[model samples]
Target: MHELKISIITVCYNAESTIERCIQSVINQYYSNIEYIIIDGGSSDATTGIIDRYKGQIQRVVSEPDKGMYDAMNKGIAMATGQVVGMLNADDVFTDNSVAGTIAAAFAENGNDILYADLNYLKPNGNVLRKWRSGQYRTGMFNKGWMPPHPTFYCKRSLYDRFGIYSLDFGTAADYELMLRFIHVKKASVFYLARVVVNMNTGGVSNNSYLGRIKVLFLDLKAMYKHDVQLPPIALLYKRLSKIRQFF
Candidate 1:
């Protein structure tokens, strides 16, 4: 079996507390051909120092100012040399050491352009707050508020090379925009892993404040229009309402 190299990117800014866990998760992956990259958005804290301590394990590190999260992610993606690439936020970690191995096997077996799994959101005390289960992909799922967890979304490097990277214009919805562009518009081949792949700490930018949620909604609408998804208004409604299930 040809072991395909997988690059996992972690983007951070002032995330000193949880960055170590993220780094360890990537380092502990069972898959041998893993390249871990970190992109820091000029954090004026101990985040850079913490990352430095793990420099021996990480393949590449970039500490600089960027437009926002999406911009930082674009930088990491650009630097990645792996056949498959994925992102893990500074406040997130892979579910287990086998994640990388499982992903590699899935890619080898299915040869899909993209592979996405489930994810869990945990409180500060490590209690499960929300469980986001991405079942499978369908023709019109995007319109029904179906989106794979961004942290669990892994795609071949060529997909980004062809469909493009995350756009900064969409604000917190950049990931959503990129997924919509690739899956709904470009019609990329995708496979579902049907397993929880990552654990995200609660209180991310999109859900931290009401204002942030509003901004995300506006940007999501813009993304739907930009990608020419039919019935955007209904899709936006479905997107907002679909989150109700995650809490249960």
Candidate 2:
């Protein structure tokens, strides 16, 4: 195994209730070469205090204000010093202790700069609510509105140097935009690690309310137009309807 140093970033704001669980998951990773960084959005809650409990395990922690989640992620990316970088939300976690090991092995097997996999949506009681299985990436998949879950997405630091990081202007669609730009436009080499990798909690900001969803749709349309990703009106309807299958 290539013992690649992997940096996992957890961006949070006022996540006192779940930040510790997220931190524990990272600290207990079976892999040895792990760098954990936490970026706080000047949370008024006890989030930073909770993070302080694991200061020894965490390599770095930056607590300050930011424009939004994507901006906070940008800061974390700038601080990353590992060959591979991935994000673990404050409310989500690796599916197992060897998750990092599995990721390292996949990157070692092929010269794939980008790696992503399936994810499980968890209920508050720790039960699986839904499964997001991201199949292999094929050419032109983005046009059909296919996107890998951001929490399970990992890529070499060099790709960011070559392309770029999350765009603040894209808002909730920033993750979608970045993936489209990388996989479809720039044609970065990628691999799909066909297994559940992270357990993402529900109630993410973008899906919290009807208004949020509407905003996401507008931003997504903007991104698709800018990248020249053809999203036919019928295809857009199918895209929204397809998510229903992820649920039970």
Candidate 3:
């Protein structure tokens, strides 16, 4: 059971400022069988340089231009050779080193197809801006604006084989669309790990500005429509409202 191979992928494009910490967190994991793969989007900055410094520890490194983060994620998925797969973004860090092993044990023991947990949204100075507690997942939760923190979500590689990888159609909300498709649409099995597993940086593309939020809403509505989601306007409202709890 301890021998289950888990693939961890990190996608970056000119993320030199924070990529090193992200890489360090993955390499520091005590999990014996982590296949660490880095997908670089032909960064013109020193991002590739920092990655190069860890060449011996990293399993696979692909430096080239890609469509976007989702496209890069698909490339990493294709390159993964593990029984379970998860992603850690360039600007994100695991809450602790044990996170990888904890995830592996959960999969190796419980036999869940999808697993996710809590997260902390951190400001630039490393202050906690919000605490994302993904307490539980139930049918119809998505309509009420509920979903797992994607950074901590891990699943069997076979799930992607069955359902499909991230879709580019959703734009910045592809992660949201993918979750809606897999858990809600296909009804895959999931487990909640309870513990906080990731510390994500604030100010992602979607919430970066008012205009950005509007664009994401348009894309999200389109995704909800494709999945036959009910009361999308209300769902979107619920989704935004739910985030308020994170700041408390």
Cα RMSD (angstroms) for every candidate in the order listed = 0.9, 1.2, 0.9
**Tens digits of per-residue lDDT for model 2, 48-100:** 99999999999999999999999999999999999999999999988899899
The per-candidate count of clashes, in order, stands at 0, 0, 0
**lDDT for 47 (candidate 1):** 99
Q: How high is the lDDT of residue 14 in model 2?
A: 97
- Inter-residue clash pairs, candidate 1: none
Better of 2 and 3 by TM-score: 3
The whole-model C-alpha lDDT of candidate 3 against the native structure comes to: 0.92
Per-candidate Cα lDDT values, in order, are 0.92, 0.90, 0.92
| Candidate 1 colliding pairs, count | 0
Q: Once model 1 is optimally superposed onto the true structure by TM-score, how far is the C-alpha of residue 36 displaced, in angstroms?
A: 0.6
Q: Worst 10-residue stretch by lDDT in candidate 1? A: 140-149
